[model samples]
Target chain A: MKNQWIHIFSGTVKVKLTGKGIERFLNQLTKNGVSIWNVRKHGSEAVTFYVNLQDVKKLRIPARDSNCKIRFLERAGGPFFLSKLWTNSGFFIGACLFLGLIMLLSNMVWGIEIRGANPATEHHIRKELDKMGISVGKMQFSIDNVESVQRELTDKIGALTWIGVELKGTTYHFQVVEKSEPKKAEVIGPRHLIAKRKAAIVKIFVEKGEPVVKVNDYVLPGQLLVSGLYGNEDDMKTVAASGEILGETWYSTKVELPLKSTFQVFNGSEKRKYSLKIAGRTLPVWGFGDPDFKEYETEVNDHPIKFFKWELPLMVEKKTLREREEVTRIYSREEAVESAKELARKDIKNHLPENAIIKGEKILHQSIENDKVKLTTHFTIIEDIAVGQPISQGD
Target chain B: MAKKWGQYVRKWMTQKMDLPQDVMMDLPRITMIGQVHIYIENHRGLLAFSDGEVRLMIKHGQLLVKGKAFVIKTILPEEILLEGKIDQVIYIND
Candidate 1:
């Protein structure tokens, strides 16, 4: 290590001396305290030696006194290499020009892409964007106001609901969401309100139609509850019906619940497995053996390694397997009855409309057989049962 | 007779002064590392260097080194380090 530094700092040079007096010349240099090494002799006349740059100039008198001809072979060191590089300027200029060209080319927008849009919609947006001076081959820094261009596109075309502009590498990526217009409502000319369900009438209110059925009347389905036309038959006027008729209704639901139930309960024993996920591919590093469990559920938790503002493609995933066991428990008669009624209530609740309110609830009948309970529950509901029925063309 | 007596007195002086044998006798202490490196202490000057041979002047004789592609690593006043494939080394009594 020390020898290399000595050679470099001293800046050694190779010299070749030829003639009958080369030995005397070397011996004289040696005696003069000039260190030279690695001497190779050729035919007792020519000799080559490496000496420091400082000592090469001091060899003049010795070479002259010994009558030996001297010639320099090579000069080596950092300074010599730098001097040679400085003499040739064409390579450095070409390299700098190449780098500048690459920088300029990479900063210009080359391709424009529209994502998440249909072709026709994409064409429309592209046209709108082009009119706003956002297009390919433009310099990236020219678009100083991206939101203004987006607003211009929105004002020119009604098809874009939301839009985002992003510049990635040399491509200009545009994200777009198309607009959807609300549908128009249809109007049926004139109609009458009739009984939609078989129930005893609780109350009736005429908002914009004449009442055809009175309160407390048990009406069958399809019967007219309100008339769309008013006045006499000779001077009859047609009108749209609008009214509300509340009916006291009854609903029955049948349920069967078993006295013994089997359930899967987690046993609190868990095993964890680790894996390294790279680009959506998982490679297991340890724990290759299978988990000791009969029935289990796997829950995966992952922690992704992120750098700065970007989430890297690598992650560590831990999978935990929770062991489970099937546990059966016998239910009492009263518990079975309670469960059956709850089941019936839930079933009836699903069938009722939004406006129907449960005024009364009770279990009417319940019977147990073969380790099971069968029950029927009744619910009293009050709701607006008036439905629209259009009049015939004869009217 | 005087020269033989001088040699005896020099040996007795070396032992009395507790000096190293190579330094007292001015002999070349040659060391080698495998066949790739060789170091010679107490060398005087270079005699010849070729592709397959190297010769140097020691105190008592000329040291000949047979090798392939020999190159001198470094040289100081007291020691010279040589590197390459060294096959054999011999001392010429001349």
Candidate 2:
């Protein structure tokens, strides 16, 4: 039974023998060591039996000696199949070419996504990517890796502050951060320094103006902190007021913090499985067994094979199993309240000027409700609050 | 006279040593599966074969198998596999 395939693969022939003494011819064949089976007598002078295709040539001798005519009834097995394939060689070649084309297309870059860039910069980036051989329809292997791409892009585009490049399957994703243009210096004329916001003066230094208000004085918006006039009123001459005034400003912010939070974190034990997907059926090529971990996360990435612009039904799927554990953090009421105040201070600091100094923070209210801590905090920031106002002719 | 003496001595040796007659005496060994198939080992040659009967030359005689719808399942130099509905097996002394 095990050798059945071997028997068929070597080929077989059904032969019909016609002679006066067919049995003698069969016996002669057997004596010649030509293993024959399924011998059936046809009429009184004819017989039919199956023999190995290779031994057909040997039958000519006994066939001549016995004076019998041997006609091949049927030819089968591997050789016949190969000859049939040869008859349709064109179709076979076409199928092979189609498969090869599909394999080539599946490994090409189909799309390039440029994010966080304006139209002009995006066009520029696309040109650069083309120069690097990373454009659409190009083979992925010919292009550089993502890290090198990022480095090259950052180096080539002077206006870009930072750029991130990622190759996701057949698509390339680019994240670009462009450098902001610096502000030009403005020409100053005769002007007074006025408070842009209501604040209590903390410190004042006048470089080219008369100090009209002293430190610890409270001023409103549009009020003059330093006048452009110099000396007494009789000898007053107007000039640009150049000064730095540190004023104290206050901001109230509300923040909420949850006392309990639950999140999942990976423990770093990972197992990868690779499989070929043909028309929705998956055939695992590696990593046959499923992961034994009970609590885990599965990330499946499917790369669909393509032929030219059309996507083929075949795909390659990669599954990553990572062991994960759920972590629940519980914070005490005091800790929650403290974090809430800290959050509120950070919130106010973000809206303040770059050189602003946080003087103090006072919690106006604190309450715990529904497993959450809510806090209202007031922050005092000391920053430069003076803005130059041009002196009009009427003034 | 010489052949008879050799055969007698071979028969006596087979009985004394408890040896298989087919091995010691050049006799044909026939194995039958029910009435449908038969295997003949150590046969000299096939003399005649038909749908109703099969004849083979044995060491001392010709073995005949009378049956219906007889088909030779396999044929080798030293063995034959015959398939049919068998009625009788007879040996003709020459």
**Per-residue lDDT value at A106 in model 2:** 70
Interface C-alpha RMSD after superposing true interface residues, each candidate, one decimal = 3.7, 2.1
Residue by residue across A34-125, what tens digits does model 1's lDDT show? 77887665665777888888888898988877778999999987667677788777899888988667655665668888887888888888
DockQ, computed on Cα atoms, for candidate 1: 0.15
**Residue-level lDDT for A136 in candidate 1:** 82
- Model 1 alpha-carbon miss at residue A91, Å: 3.4
Scored on chain A only, each candidate's TM-score is 0.51, 0.51
Name the runs in model 2 displaced over 4 angstroms.
A1-10, A77-92, A177-395, B66-70, B84-94
The clash count of every prediction, one per candidate, is 0, 0
Judging by lDDT against the true structure, name the best candidate: 2
> What clash count does candidate 1 reach?
0
lDDT by residue (tens digit), candidate 2, A1-395: 12335758888899998887777787788888888888898888888888888999999988788778999999888898789789999999999998898789778998999999989999999998889888889976456557778999999998799998987767888888888745688779999999988899999988988778888999998899989987787877889998899999887888988999999999889898989999999999998787878788897877666665567798778788999989999999988887777788778878987889999988889889999998888888899989999888586
